[model samples]
Target: MKTALRTTTKTGTFAQALEDFKQITKVGLAVSVVFSSVAGYFLGAETIDYKVLLLLMIGGYFMVGASNAYNQIIERDLDALMKRTMNRPVPSGRMSVNTAFIIATVCAVLGIVILYMVNPKTAMFGAISIFLYTSVYTPLKTKTPLSVFVGAFPGAIPFMLGWVAATNTFGIEPGTLFMIQFFWQFPHFWAIGWLLYDDYKKAGYYMLPTGKKDSATALQVIMYTIWMIIVSVFPVTGLTGRLHLSVTGAVIVALLGVGMLYFAIRLYHEKDNAAARKLMLASVAYITFVQIVYVADKFIGGY
Candidate 1:
């Protein structure tokens, strides 16, 4: 009985920790940071500094966690109203605002310090990402539908942030990565916005252009999906200079873009919740696979 009880208690604790971590930051942001840094390492001449990369990952996680915590604190009321977010630690009162604030502040400070150790430019960008996310984007969600576009700026930074951290300089390679991600965010996020439009409205958040689900929103998603494909393949054309890809690499990249395009088109035509959900999942896979391909191609003497 005692052994069983202990096992049950451990399971519960693990669940709680997962919930708290999601509330504090998010898995998406953490993964993005790691991927971007890896991509950046490749961009910075395919050199890796394990120590610096470790520091940057730690700092990135902390900063992202801090931003999420602050967002929850500010949106606690709205969060409670949205079915999707109602059970979050803050809205559910599983954690208090005061405690969350202290945790966030400490994390932000530590993140900045670590990033500074990596490079001043990286540190500055990290600070800027946090500032824009917490200070500007969070509040704007309730005020306007355009907030999604505004939020994309910070959302797209992690990939490029890695390049700057790796090279301690901003140049064409990082810029290319930045542009790819920047364009990618729209279709990716719009798919999510479609899936959660109703949930968002209940909380007074306008995540879609029309603040309603319709063809216009879906069309916009399709357009951006097309743009994302175009940008993702740009490196192959030599327009990205040092980031140029070889024919084989370009073909692989084009295949990934086609995968993304397939989902986007499915979502556009179906205009159903299930299709949108699938598209969102596909978008996640698309980004992860493309980043992996990019890093591998760079290292393996691929184009």
Candidate 2:
């Protein structure tokens, strides 16, 4: 009985630790970022190299995980004040700050080293992303609403980072990818800000463009959504280098944009949390489907 009890306790402890790690690193968000990187790689590579692709996946996850971990550490107290974040590992006392810091530091170093194996530029951008997220965006969250704009920089890099990893170049192709993601973030994050406004206020976070959930903020979301749609179809213009899109792909992407824009417009008219939540979901689907369409167009459409 004693031995069995000890084994059970050990297993329970390990399981809890794993759960804490996932919460701290935000595994879902990290995976989506990796997905974007992989899609960009597919768009740029003439022939796939499995080894480099694997490196990008691992390195990208570690970098994003490190950034999230550091952000949690910095915002532990503020996190405790917000219901949405109060259950997180550090804020809930499931994990120690020092432990989280060590994990973050290790992940950052390993991520940069692995990305360096892919290319120096990949590693450099990875480092810049971490710096921007933790150093700039994290601190600015409580200070000003413009932090959303600043946060978009690191958020936008993963898509282009994949292209750079494949081509070792920062040309119009990667630039287009960057712009698409950059513009997309405003609507995506604003919807989240709308839904979580009350919780964010508890932590003194100013996430909305207008510092309030009003028509002005909704208008900006619509405007940025329009810009995101325009950029998503820009590859059809044949100016995005090897990242060309067929007319069919462009039309499908525009349709997806319209679907997302419908949700945004609903939020504008309804001005309710439900509408904002729907817009948020639509934004996620739009970005993922748009990336799929772009990659599919390149491979299947032969454009």
Which structure among the candidates has the greatest TM-score?
2
Name model 1 segments beyond 4 Å from true: 1-19
RMSD of each: 2.6, 0.6
Clashing residue pairs in all predictions, respectively, total 2, 0
Tens-place lDDT digits, model 1, residues 24-131: 677676667666766666666446788988887888888788888888889999999989889888889888889889888998899899999999998998899899
Q: Model 2: which residue pairs collide?
A: none
Report the Cα lDDT for residue 26, model 2: 97
Alpha-carbon error at 254 in model 2, in Å?
Answer: 0.4
Provide the lowest-lDDT 10-residue window in model 1.
38-47
Candidate 2 lDDT, 1-303, residue by residue in tens? 999999999999999999999889899999999999999999989889999999999999999999999999999999999998999999999899999999899999999999999999999999999999999999999999999999999999999999999989898999999999999999999999999999999999989999999999999999999999999999898887888999999999999999999999999999999999999999999999999999998889865
| TM-scores, all models, native as reference | 0.92, 0.99
Which residue pairs does candidate 1 place in steric collision?
245-303, 246-303
